[model samples]
Target: MSEQALTLKQSGIRWLWLAVVIFVADIAIKFVVMENMGYGWSNRIEVLPFFNLLYVHNYGAAFSFLSDQSGWQRWFFTAIAFAVTGMLSYWMSKLPAKEKWNNIAYAMIIGGAVGNVFDRVVHGFVVDYLDFYWGTYHWPAFNLADTTICIGAAMIIIDSFRSEKKSD
Candidate 1:
């Protein structure tokens, strides 16, 4: 292999490492919440009136949307998660060597997706535990993986708006 090719391989490894770190951290936090807090429970550590350390499990997509569907939904979302992870991995490989932020964003998304995918595969659902609310209305409960995925998606949108070139 050429010197440039070796360097590219090394760079890709670095990005994969980043993804691994996020994935581990995400699972670790979830494990703690699951083991200690229990499902559909909350330990309110009110950072603000609208925020709390609430624990809830989601059987489906964001906000428990479609979580009420028949048993088939779990496997369906898991399949989608695997597909997304594969696509994100591909994007990471072609990511520009100098665009560290962009690479990190892709890593975050891939890591988060894989993390939740594991839960779906193993438990047939996702364990979500963070809660945000306003007045009597409550936002969906989510975990680190979901937050990272959202951040990564936002960065991707911003990057696109900035007209960054997709490196081959």
Candidate 2:
């Protein structure tokens, strides 16, 4: 029997739907948070022993890096998101449909990045609401987009350990 060749799904762009879903869900939740919740730490709603719904904004990247800058970081991060999303989409188009892990990971990153870009463009900052804490200390606030990106990044890292022969 001959070795079967992999078909990368109409160039694998099909996987991008997962990205779109993430973008839509993130934006929709942000909209809900903005419409129903008051902003700032004083307005946070305690949801559980370790979590709260806190509406806030991040003007910079992960962990609020550069959040204190005047204003240039907004466009800078937006530009980076555009470039990275484009690159990931391109990679998805070239990857095999059978490579579900990598394709889905790329789609997730694309979705999450685009969602954050939308926030940066429309609101001048990313909307963060989910807050976790340990007694007096708290993890930096984040949103669904941040969650998706982190999960996607982890998927890619896990994929890295797989034998490359699986792809070929």
Candidate 3:
């Protein structure tokens, strides 16, 4: 660990609290969904004309990719999530705490990744809710963790553009 990392407030790792918050909230919400809702398409509760609360388990990554595979994907995704969380946490620890944008973004991603990983380990699948649809077409159901991950990834991309502008 570097000198900066030794100083608790000085390191961007301070933002890890946000990650913990996100992780806890994600897990609690998943629990709520599981306990309250019956599984599958038939049990979905329409929240709005275009939205629904649907509890489903995703055995694969986003959009249920490779969800049909014979069970290996759960471990694969869990491993990848932990690797990513580790890398991001390391980066956060090295960065100055003043680097709010990237730190927050990384924290969000780390939180989401860990949340999903927990699901894979405990339930053998990621529990998904929140369905959005338009007419007969429907977008994939996802949860708060996915939302945070996507938002964090977008923030990182946006940060790249800012860095480029500053350099140029």
**TM-scores of all candidate predictions against the true structure:** 0.86, 0.91, 0.96
- CA lDDT, candidate 1, residue 133: 90
RMSD of each: 3.2, 4.6, 1.8
Q: Rank the candidates by lDDT, best first.
A: 3, 2, 1
Model 2 per-residue lDDT tens digits across residues 49-141: 999998999999999999999999999999999999989987887777667888888988999999999999999999999999999999999
lDDT tens digits, residues 119-161, model 3?
A: 9999999999989999999999999999999999999999999
Candidate 2 backbone collisions, by pair: none
**How many residue pairs clash in each candidate at the backbone level?**
0, 0, 0
Task: Look at candidate 3 and give me any clashing residue pairs.
Answer: none
Sort the candidates on TM-score, descending order. 3, 2, 1
Off by over 4 Å in 1: 1-13, 41-47, 164-168
lDDT scores of the candidates, listed in order: 0.80, 0.90, 0.94
- What lDDT score goes with residue 112 in model 3? 96
User: Which has the higher lDDT value, candidate number 1 or candidate number 3?
Assistant: 3
